[model samples]
Target: MNQLSIFLAAGGGKGGEMQLLMMGAIILVFWLFMIRPQAKKAKQQKQFINDMKKGDRVVTIAGIHGTINKINDDGTLELQTSPGSYLKIERSAISLEWSQQINKAAATTVTPTK
Candidate 1:
């Protein structure tokens, strides 16, 4: 036991530096797996919202489906749910994934006339 304690004490000087290196690695892994993807997604969402225009079909985070009738200057959208039914919602309420899925499906289902 005396020899084991002396061995451990002699090697203790490098342990703090190893711990700091491990901590840095953990932080790098966490940022790559968690923070980086979230920030990229937020940037994509912002771009999607900015690209909105009249007549673009979209789905809201609340699951409301509509076509944009008007782009308001105050960060809001005038959504037309039906021929005459309209709802005013914030631009950020649009779901990028849902809207893209819906639009992609619509594009593929269109039958071209000869």
Candidate 2:
């Protein structure tokens, strides 16, 4: 007999159901621990990209920092890195987490003028 038949014969038919249960549990755990969070993060990233507008400070995935000069209709943006210096980049290239961190730091680090 083949190894598959020998193994099933050894287990007396309970092994097949047990294997199915284990596979289902593994799929559930994988969805919970991996797929769910990734989908949520992707949704948040899409929302962030849609909310971007002119003059918002942002950091690209490649770590380029700039202010939004203009948002193009073709899924691109004009990023002003410095005075008279600009780079055109895709809207999806912005790093949502890094931009939030920098904006949060800037908001908290403001000083009052005397």
Candidate 3:
């Protein structure tokens, strides 16, 4: 077992480099799968919020549905939920995917004549 012990001791010196490479690969994969997608989605959401204007239909992240009555310059918006009923919320409170899906379903429900 003397040769085996020498072989293991010699190989132990290279383990640090191998472990560092493995950790780097893991970090790269994690960024590609998790961090990258989350950043992209956040950018899209910010764009969607910025492009909004008065009279736009929207659904908040809290599931509150309303039409935008006014787009305030101070980073807030007034939403009209019902007749004479309104709620003021932040632009970031809107949900991009939910609003888009709800709008899509609405558009598909109404068929036009040829």
Candidate 4:
């Protein structure tokens, strides 16, 4: 009765191959647009986390901002919120992009020539 019914009626011998090709195409496009980029971003994030060092300013996904005071051997970080005030947090909680953006913005906002 509908367009789908009409299409199904018309598609007899070649319909199975067409459906398989279309499904394969859909999967390819989905991986190209979605899965691949997400995996790449995850790899970059892991690299960023591994590269972090003491005295580096960073922000967490929870919106906490601090400076790295110490790198623990147990996959955790000691963050200094202020002088003599420290908080221990997991390394994975750090947000690489937010920290970089904030630090860059802070750097740009200050007029060095002044």
Which structure is stronger by TM-score: 1 or 3? 1
Per-residue lDDT of candidate 2, residues 65-106 (tens digit): 999999999999999999999999999999999999989999
In terms of lDDT, the best-performing candidate is 1
Judged by whole-model lDDT over C-alpha atoms, candidate 2 comes out at 0.96
Model 1 C-alpha lDDT per residue in residues 17-44, reported as the tens digit of each score:
8999999999999999999999999999
Summing lDDT over every window of 10 consecutive residues in candidate 2, give the lowest-scoring window.
Answer: 7-16
TM-score of 3: 0.89
Q: Judged by lDDT relative to the true structure, which candidate is superior, 2 or 4?
A: 2
Instruction: For model 1, name the residue pairs that clash.
Output: none
TM-score sort, best first? 1, 3, 2, 4
For candidate 4, the per-residue lDDT at 54 reads 95
lDDT by residue for model 3 over 8-97, one digit each (tens)?
Answer: 999997998899999999999999999999999999999999899888889999999999999888899999999899999998999999
Give lDDT per model, in order. Answer: 0.97, 0.96, 0.94, 0.94
Q: Residue 42 CA error for candidate 4 (Å)?
A: 0.4
Model 3 ranges with Cα > 4 A deviation: 1-5
lDDT-superior candidate, 1 or 3: 1
